[model samples]
Target: MTKTARQLQEEGLLYDVFEQELTDIKDRTYGLVSELSRASYFDTEYVMSLVRKIVAKIGQDSYIVPPFRCDYGDHVFIGNNTYINYNCCFLDSAKVTIGDYVYMGPNCNIFTPCHPIHHELRKEKVTEYALPVTVGSHSWIGGDVVITPGVTIGENCVIGAGSVVTKDIPDNSIAVGNPCKVIRQVNDKDREYINSLILDDETKNSKYKQEHGYVYSAKDEAIFNIVKDTVHYVEILNKLSNSEIQRRRDFLRTFVAKLDEGAMINSPFYMEFANHLEMGVNSFINYDCIMLNNAMVKLGDNVLVGPKVSFYTAMHPIDAKQREQWLVYAKPITVEDNVWIGGSATILGGVTIGKNAIVGAGAVVTKDVEPNTIVVGNPARVLRKITAEDSKKYQEELAKQKDINKSEFDKMMAGQWYNAMDYSMLKLRQENNKKTEAYSRITINTLSYKDRMAKAIVKEFGENANIIPPFTCDYGCNVKVGNNTVINHSGVFLDTNEINIGKHALIGPKSGLYGAIHPFDVEARNEGIEKAKTINIGDGAWLGGKVTVVPGVSIGKHSVIGAGSVVTKDIPDDVVAVGNPCRVIRKITEDDKINPIRKK
Candidate 1:
């Protein structure tokens, strides 16, 4: 007969089991914590009440951000004025004691349970044991840091970003890196240096430099000049009139640190500092991509980046107050040769995407991706290695495209589509759409408000460029509709990836332009992951009512899509495409343009 949980705990046994029959207290408590994790980040009192119910003891004035979790909260203890950041997880299978004035950064994990290594020992009626984890008072744990079981972090410690602590740490030390080690002790000399850096400001009674220790005077000549030049480039692209391809390319190349021969960046790209941004030969950067390069970001030769992809090298303090003070740091990001990053993928700081790796769309990559591997979903996991089967399809479909190399990672980079539904992505879209939905409710009849709404998407609305109200998008900032473009009412333009509409383009009412899509597999779809591709509608293009254009599609210059057509494939220039899976019906001729006639 199986022993009761209390009896098993008294004997020190395993508990992270899936099929085990937990008691009502455990069931309800775990369920309650799940609900609390889904609660609003702003609901401090409510979440704190729930936190108190779960933890063994929590001290006064200690605040934990919502969406925190533990296996058994009853084994956890927290001290006074301790603050935990977003999405922190603790496995309180054994005791977890966090002392006073502690700071925990976002995405930090403190696990106290170890699984059995022996296969036979994991069978029914198996025994288990867990080690405890402790963090002494007045310490700071950086983002993405992980502390393993049986680790006791000392008081007044500073654990650096991405550090993994597997052993005990002494007090008043700075610990960092995988298998963390102390670098130095905090001393008064550090305080003296910090005091000297502080700037004085006038107040009624006294002068003070800052509200937090993290704040410092941020000044960089390179970054300052880069920002100004980049802004000017964006303005030029938004109002670009002449279609001199070479001139356009030349203008765009000046925005980045390096743009090799045959490299192409679809217009309306965004970056914090262009000086640190470098692109190798024949690399393809699709529309509406955002690169926050506080540190160097380099993409190797033949790299293909899909739409709305983002690389962030900037990060802030774990302490909320410190973040408010705008104290920040950054790490560089590098993409090796022949890599392809799908649309809507977000690569985090200090991550190096290996050569020929394919990062699936909508993946929130927090770690380095291995070379020649395909990774998908939140905290992206490797799906499989690039095989011959994948390469065969690549040769068949996009053979005509230049720089379509068969390097290990680039073959069919966009072929594998998986579903990844993330909480953070969902939350962001929800917040963004809320604002767009409000704009949708505004009176479409008014020209001024309509113009104001159009400004949300287009930087410079050209001669008669306008959008009828009832518009919806993930973010308006990525889109730039060109001159004489008329987007009809109730248009759902999913601008998660950049949507570029050229001059004289006519979009019928209720047409949906989707730049990103989720995995089709039921399980993957449930994961809320996505793959994005840019949708480009060239000049003189026309779309009928209720047309839907899927991701990574391009409607060629002066092409026409019939009513209610679903465009899954790219249509060539000056063609008439129509159908559920829209196909070309006929080519546009001079006879068809001046006067209407049936092609016989």
Candidate 2:
């Protein structure tokens, strides 16, 4: 008896994706998904009913946010108390099993189909395979994560944000990055951390001490009740449509201590103490902002707080014993008038930003920022003082930039389609090739000469950074390697555009980073139209032998890409990812630490 396409797929054999049976199932699933998407998010009972009709099994208290997509609804199984956030996609060609008490953040994707590598075979609708994906009980998957086919995430695991999970993750692990690896185990420290947030009665009385730079407990009954109420209020505010502006304002006025006239905060804002937050007139707080305002957090007039900015006024004791005792403290955070806090910046407790200050993206502010200055990087060092000349320079540049036509090179640099075979581009590539070829010709034994030639080949070559003599790149000038980075033998960096490698990186032998991307359309390809995207390898990343990173992919800090992996997307920091089409297996953890080997 011959097996059907569905049967073949389930049996881990190659099958056609466009089989009549699969297409019919998918069409049904799409109808249900469309219905689910159209339904109101507030209609909980109706939403759950639709979800039940869609999935194979939905345990008690399981909820899926609207706008969810999946190939076959019957192949998806979700356990009890599982809360899946918005815009999640599950390509359940095979079984997709999600365990109980699992929390999946927004925009998570799970793929169960593997298409043929050969484009001709794929075009012919042959050699597609499906595999199961399972998430164990009590696991948390962060936003924008992708879990590939045949992957099993063990119980009590924490998969961090923006991870591409391609392999099995072990139980009780905390993993993060592109190809996620275990960074640590879920242990007593985690439990203690949670416990330390809960305060006893005696510690609660020390609230006055918090204002005076002394330790206090925030777990007071009144505070807990306030936080709970705030959570409920925020949830409602977040759910409300943008059209209900007046209603949102009214709710905010009632919930927050002082929300001045003309001040606005975008939806999806989170706060522990809403009553402790004060916004001045005309101040604007962007989306996904978080304020743990145990103490007062005040933003002055005309302040611009970017998206994902966090103002933290809480602190725990440094000593483990003291921390375990639940001793915590709070200090006020103040943003003066005309301050601009960039996206993803964290403002720590007891910090003040002087007027007209600018905090750069991803900066960690620990101390006060000086007035009229631009601060950037970790620990928020002052990049430069704001000068009158700066305004003039930018204004003049803006005037000159208006309605200007960009060249092919400029378009290419901006990640737009361009003529790749232009004369200037060809000349640049030819010159780069000469330098690379010259560097390759030098012997490894001639250390000084080789090092000098290596520097001549690339732009911005950092101190102690080394690329073996046999390494190659299309445009050496587009490559910028940081201090202490090493590119092993036979490495290929097709740096059509910028390829920035962070410090302490290890690019294994035969590894390739391809920045160039040709158009998918045959006509565009024939016309020599192409574009290039930047590839970034973050600090301390290790790519094993024969790993291939495609255009626009960023391997995050301290990440490990396994051998023979092909990275197609961004990998977050601190993970171990492996497989063909690399995915995070687990995260790098403290347990992975080993003592330095001694000489025999």
Candidate 3:
């Protein structure tokens, strides 16, 4: 007869149970994790209730921050007055018991399940066993420490930051380093002063927390502002005509600490603290990498962080009371030389991925990865070592694909419709969006300011041609203006297709010129498929306010289009047109002939 999971567990014997049964309970814990991760920082009481529903036992006074994760919440127990910081992962396949008055710092990890050393057995998933972990009262586990299965930390012990404890530590001991060992023992005299200190003494002093660099320091504020500006600035640079390398360098100088020449990050990169970010020579980052570089995000030479790879550094306290005021701390993230991080991978705080390490796509890394290793999956584990031959193969594959990327980029610029999902095309679109945002932010009150803005985006910005304030367009580069053209304020130039304006043209306020036509079918619209046709306006043409010119439509030279007109078809030269689905009401009258439209 088969023994039940409870029976095997009681006997301390290895056993295999259906993974689906265990997963059902774990799924419920994930629901709670999601709620806590997204809950408002001020909802302290609500967050505590959610925690109580998960853990088998927790002290009444203790609280933890959001974004805490556990495999089986009921196996974990906490004592009174304990504090935990943000983004902690507790893999409690077995019991984890914490004593009272303990402090576990940010990004800490506690694991209690290990696979068999025999590869064949591990692959079969034949056996599983868990060992419980214990920490005595009044102990402090520093930031980024990792405690392996069954490690018993004794009373009044201090585990230094970044230590990996694989063995038990005795009472009154201070331990530090990988495969942690006891450093020194604290005697009764030391315990006297330590016990006298209270956690509230430093935290309750609001003025001290604000003034000192304890939270959101003065330097941090400065770095944040510069990061905001540069974040937008880099997007514009990415859209430049391939000759504006100097402008990119000038923008990079504003923030980016310790950057070497020849390094480039694709547009739409994200970061909050630029002063702590470092990049070495020739490192190229693809689009949309988020680096929360508060402590420091350091990248070594020849690193290639692919699109959507994110680096995190910020963390909040576990105690809901401390988290309520938005209290937080940070740790550094380091990526060494020749590392290739795959697309959509996330490297968290206090992680140092060593040189030549390759993180697989969509992996979520939590711990330090050794040099020349390949890791993949959630809570990423080492898959294999990367040999020198593997690096050569990777280079060859990328070299083969470089031509394909350049082909897509060229097709978009050549007026041919292409797939927007293509990497190079999206990069170009985001680049254009960035420039448009910057142009819109400026107050274009005068012709000089308008010219300054136009020069940045418009390819054929003619002499003395001015578009009034609040002009918007899909692609400014597609619009061309002849000499002495005046576009009035609040005009919408949908320039997905070519918009060619002759000399001495007058575009009235609140006018719209649309060139792109979308399909009526729902699937086509949802897929974002569209076609654009050119719009041409003749010399000395006058367009009145609230006029709408559809795609493939033209107004003849010296023609007059009246207010509230919708031009669906071409109008002949020297005619006056008005009204919906506009047609020529009459030939140019004496009044129209006498007052030809002139540049404002």
Tens-place lDDT digits, model 3, residues 143-235? 546687668999878876545577899987888654467878865554343223223454444324322323433234444355556545544
Give stretches of model 3 more than 4 Å off: 17-20, 187-600
Please estimate how well model 2 matches the true structure, expressed as its whole-model Cα lDDT: 0.70
List the global CA lDDT of all models: 0.63, 0.70, 0.63
Tens-place lDDT per residue, model 2, 139-169, is 8786546687789999878876545686899
TM-score of each: 0.43, 0.48, 0.42
Worst 10 residues of 1 by lDDT: 204-213
Clashing pairs in 1: 13-128, 14-128, 356-409, 419-519, 420-527, 420-528, 420-529, 421-527, 421-528, 421-529
Reference-based TM-score, model 2? 0.48
lDDT of 1: 0.63
Sliding window of 10 residues with minimal summed lDDT for model 3: 591-600
1 or 2, greater by lDDT? 2
lDDT by residue for model 1 (1-600), tens: 977665545334654233354444555565666667555544568888888988888899888875576666888899988888655667666789999888786546776654332222322322335678899887888655668767899887888754557689999888865446788887766555544544454331111121122233233343445555665565455334222345756877767789888676654355656677788977777544666566778998877776546676765443334433434556689899877776546687789999778886545577999887888654578988876666565445444545634331122234333222234444545455555555554531333466766675444566667676556676675577887677755476666566888887777654668676543222232233345577899887777554667788999987877654557789989888765457798887665532111111
Between prediction 1 and prediction 2, the one with superior TM-score is 2
Q: Candidate 3, after superposition: displacement of residue 319 in Å? A: 20
